[model samples]
Target: MKLIGIILLFVTSMQAQNFELRVQAKTVIPGKKIYLEYITDLGKVIKIDSAVPSAQHTVNFKGQVKDQGAFYLLNFFDTPKPQKVLVILEGGEFIDIVADGVNDEDGKGNFTMKGDYPNVKYMLELMAISKEMETKVRKWNQEIQLDQKQEKRIQAEFTQAQTASTAKIKALIPQMGSHLVALWATNFLPAEKEMTSLVEIADRLGKARPAHPQVRQFVANLQRLQGVNEGALAPEINLATPEGPTLALSSLRGKYVLIDFWASWCGPCRRENPNVVKTYAAYKDKGFEIFGVSLDQNREAWLKAIESDKLVWKHVSDLQYWNSAGAQAYQVNSIPQTFLVDPAGRIIAKGLRGTALDQYLAKLFESK
Candidate 1:
């Protein structure tokens, strides 16, 4: 009896952190392999394992999950374009996927996922909604780009679609409760506009999956967001200027500052420079300043862009490219990103461009 008890305990421990994923393909071609892949925090996709379907047209993958909230991609690599499905696998899950061998005329996938785990079901559903939204937006943008009126109409349509998609995703969050799907749903919304909801979901997910790597990462991102959000103190940045002297953002205190993150290779940044120049010309004497931070690897190109744009501003860079110290300090993932700081050095707004920047500055300097 004692030995039998020990054996049962061992069996239970063996299966505790493991998951089994089985796929049934309707039309399995010879020599084609299926891959199980996961993306890293840095957005690099790593292929973990691959398997060939058996004579019965089924393939199985089994592994122990390191952590929950990690999204995995199942890819059928033999197709003209690989057919892929996104799935979430917590430990101790048995997930089955049915794949239709042929994609539709529009290349839409005909697949269904079944799992006893409620989170898996919810995550898959959320992924479906996200994919649908992306498809709709892409199709709308791919139309004609002839006239300004037509462009305005297309943008309005895009805005309507985005509003409806956000509403749909938000409506599903309450039903998800403390599940990670609720946290994932918040990602579909703008992070700056929905920080309160994001923080709440992060709190709930922290209680449920405290040890998960993804949860930890999400919490860290929320902390960073808090530091950069409106009314929050802007993170400090100190980098070398074009003339070889170090300048600190704190030194520019008592003035309204625009922290512009750009690079010479960025086409949009070059195009937007004229508008920025215009805004600067209007406000430079009104206690307004521009602190340009370049994420350029080449020093020559950076200097040439600054000169060519007629940008008479305090420009600084570590010239580390995307790994620029200042860019990372402010969580800048794209070029031509700007943060507006008031005289008190608090972040007033972010990502302002063109007419938006002009309108904001106009209202701000109306009194002076």
Candidate 2:
């Protein structure tokens, strides 16, 4: 459930174990508060503990943790500026931390752990490197937008940076002793390229850290990955058309169907509609069709986008924004996503957009 107070809880009830948190913050005022929060498996942020600093400019939190291997956050808004520090926490670990309350220009502090907190240290280091890599990649993206001619070099720099970061992260996996941190670290790398390592890490941790949320999440992600593999049968999407008629994705079985997920409010989808329309016009006669699923709250806007974009494809929606049945069936996290399915309802490729979409259609139509 959603949590609003300091007594919120999460999953996996285990034997209660004492967790000692020692914090030193010179910046926190004497009368203010510091909240210790933990995230639930449902992505809910809950406050588990709160403290008011005494005379020593320090706060000590002693509580019984009911879950093991979950992430915890220490949030401080009492100071002139806010501060937050993340720690990979467990049930029995007593974490001793030092916070000076004055971080660098970027608000990133030099948080250091006192005792043997290997997993936490490894996680923090990985996060620091990941942030640097993200900054570099963002620059590459900005450059690519302005200068498409140098896109190849800018893109190469991004890939090379990702490769280096992945290599460094992989080297620390075995050294972290427990696969708990390693499992969480995989989020920094591209999931497609790191699938093998992901499976190996998950298998190793599933036996040891079965109660961990990260381990459980890894297992669930792996299952979804298997279900949505390139050749797996595309998950069924049956929703209501605008005219109060039910439309099922399986009905478009015997053709090359692009299951396009979009919305009227999405700018990227509107921008990309012309490409989709062009491709459909070129390939509509050659056994190709598009099944448009919209995540829109208003039926009028949905109809407007279809007519404004001049989309001559089959369209359907349940008038539910972000909670549409079709969006959930396809596990769409963002708008303008597309999946190309073959005649027998097997997904051939995914994420084909813009010129890439045109090139794919050209190859498909020319092969015959």
Candidate 3:
């Protein structure tokens, strides 16, 4: 019985030694310390190991990699354990492991590399591409700075910079297609026709790199955004209203509804409310409605602003500031955004202000 107990203890200890990581090297300098990190849905960072392992160690994580894009790993340290870690990439690959015999004595272990085993030549190519992209962007910014100093040359230089940047990005797209698609989909792509192209790129890359999680995520995000663009049926938004009930966007169908995205702190939005109020008053009896979506952190301030501005309209918010559900659904990065939906609940116009808003309403009324 004593010998059986000893055998069970040995097995338990072995089980506890397992640490699986799907690490993407952020910055690896052969024999030096490397930095790695990852991001989650809650916007939290998970840092794994920072030690310079004398030799390669086994990193086991279940995540995918895409071509020419930032790769992330879903690290699970110890099976059936809830501990999570993230490995963020800075630049380069090739981590030198310091001799730690905890896992293996040879200082070499299995890790996911850019290319198939015994050949990592593609990683060097990726590094060069990253460096080249950085250099081009930097040079373009310098020219832009010089142009900004000269008001007369500003427009020309700005245009040139934009053209050059777009060209550089386009040229590198094939090589760094995955990274470019990820960045564009996550940050750069406008809420316009550009989105369609971005989605297409993501789809293509996802097919090429079927094992990449980032590509899958990028594709998923673009699909969601594409569903919300103009001409598409407006997504249903059911949220808490001041009247102690839930208000839904779908319920406002059959009327021209202006989804006003704003915050109490937005000076431009506050200034433009008078014009909106005038338009609302004029069109209220003509089957028009205005729904106020506040991106305010403070609920009291939002309510006070609504009352003070005499914004006698349906208002709703999840009170998440920039992280608001409506903001994410509408893909709003900035405030003072407005969407004009036709009676059929399809976005007809966006970002209309002052004269533009008035002109659109006039056209809508005249057409009726």
Candidate 4:
């Protein structure tokens, strides 16, 4: 019995997370079919399998999942729309899905799951915590704008809030063990500020979940970050301009270029445009150039933003919104991100905004 237990633990630990969905669907019309679906990390929704419940209102979906934590959906043929549920793919255990039909209050399905439940709970908690922090940040921004006199205090409060959030997340990492949350927090760690924990988590994950895609992805992202950091050659981004001309980033070599990542719909990006305009005006003559890479899906809105902001600079995009191929090459997770490149096309600085942009350019020219 002891040897069997040891063997089982060893096998389970080595295996990637599998999924088992014991679905509930008695409320559906007779002879109706239901499909099991899962969402990819890249936001692609894929159908796993389909089944007709065996009169007991039960449908079982068993499969090998590619992700440790993923969103799955139950699509009833009889229903007008599919019902979504978050499921645990963390493997080594059963995941029982309860699709009790759509909630009348929320208009969303009351699809819940049990077994290997901690990870799912963690995901919900993480999202809620993140949302709370964002709400605070948004509130502070509004307050700061209305009362510039309180800007200093508000900024301090914001910093404190962010610090607390980081600390809370960092504290949760060790508790998460080798779960997907720990690997994901690698990206959430404050880049350089939380380097120690990032390295530790990377090493821990490398040892514990080396075969996991999230671990592999975490490692890949670190490499990309290093490649794009200051002193590294700016990655080439050659895409078509709004006009039909090929606008290559490498074409602007031998000049200071700001690889500005923004979207037309981005409020912060719109707010930061005037500062970029000011910076461009001040230093365009000094071989300073702006290469605006938009994450806009609508071409008209993108063009309108450029005209409204008077962004007299080279702009290029594939116009795929958040999934822009150009943006992906740069590993952009958020808008209003900038990569300042030197004349030789090596990245010099990053994330500069407002007068910081002007000040950096001023210093660069002054130093010579």
- Clash count list over all predictions: 0, 0, 18, 2
Local distance difference test, per candidate? Answer: 0.79, 0.75, 0.59, 0.74
lDDT ranking, best first? 1, 2, 4, 3
After superposition, the stretches of candidate 2 with alpha carbons farther than 4 Å from their true spots are 1-17, 24-32, 52-58, 76-84, 91-115, 211-214, 237-345, 350-368
Candidate 4 deviant stretches above 4 angstroms: 1-64, 67-88, 92-116, 144-153, 190-196, 264-287, 295-313, 320-328, 333-336, 354-359, 365-368
Q: Each model's TM-score?
A: 0.63, 0.62, 0.48, 0.68
Model 3 C-alpha lDDT per residue in residues 190-288, reported as the tens digit of each score: 345255557667777777766655556556666676667678777777777766587889899899999988999775577668778988898898889
lDDT of 3: 0.59
lDDT of 4 at 323: 66
lDDT of 1 by residue, 1-368 (tens): 99999999988876876888899888777888888998655434679999888998889989887554467778885465567777766678899998875566656567888887867767777777877776775565456334445655665676687678777777777778866556557656666456677787889887887887777767776777667878988889999999999999989999999999998877658767877999999999999999999998889999999999999999999988866888667866566789999888899999887777899999999999
Q: Which candidate achieves the best lDDT against the true structure?
A: 1
Model 1 whole-model lDDT (C-alpha atoms): 0.79
- Per-residue error (Å), model 3, residue 149: 28
| Total clashes in model 4, counting residue pairs 3 or more apart in sequence or in different chains | 2
Expressed as tens digits, the lDDT of each residue in 1-368 for candidate 4 is: 99999999977865656666788864666776778777555545677788888767888888766655555666765364445555546665576666764444434455555664667666556656776786886787788679878866875787788788888788888887877666555545555356578767877877887776657666666656656678888888988898988788989988999999998878668867876897898889888999999998788899999999899999998888756776677666567789999988888888887656778889999855
| Highest TM-score against the true fold, candidate | 4
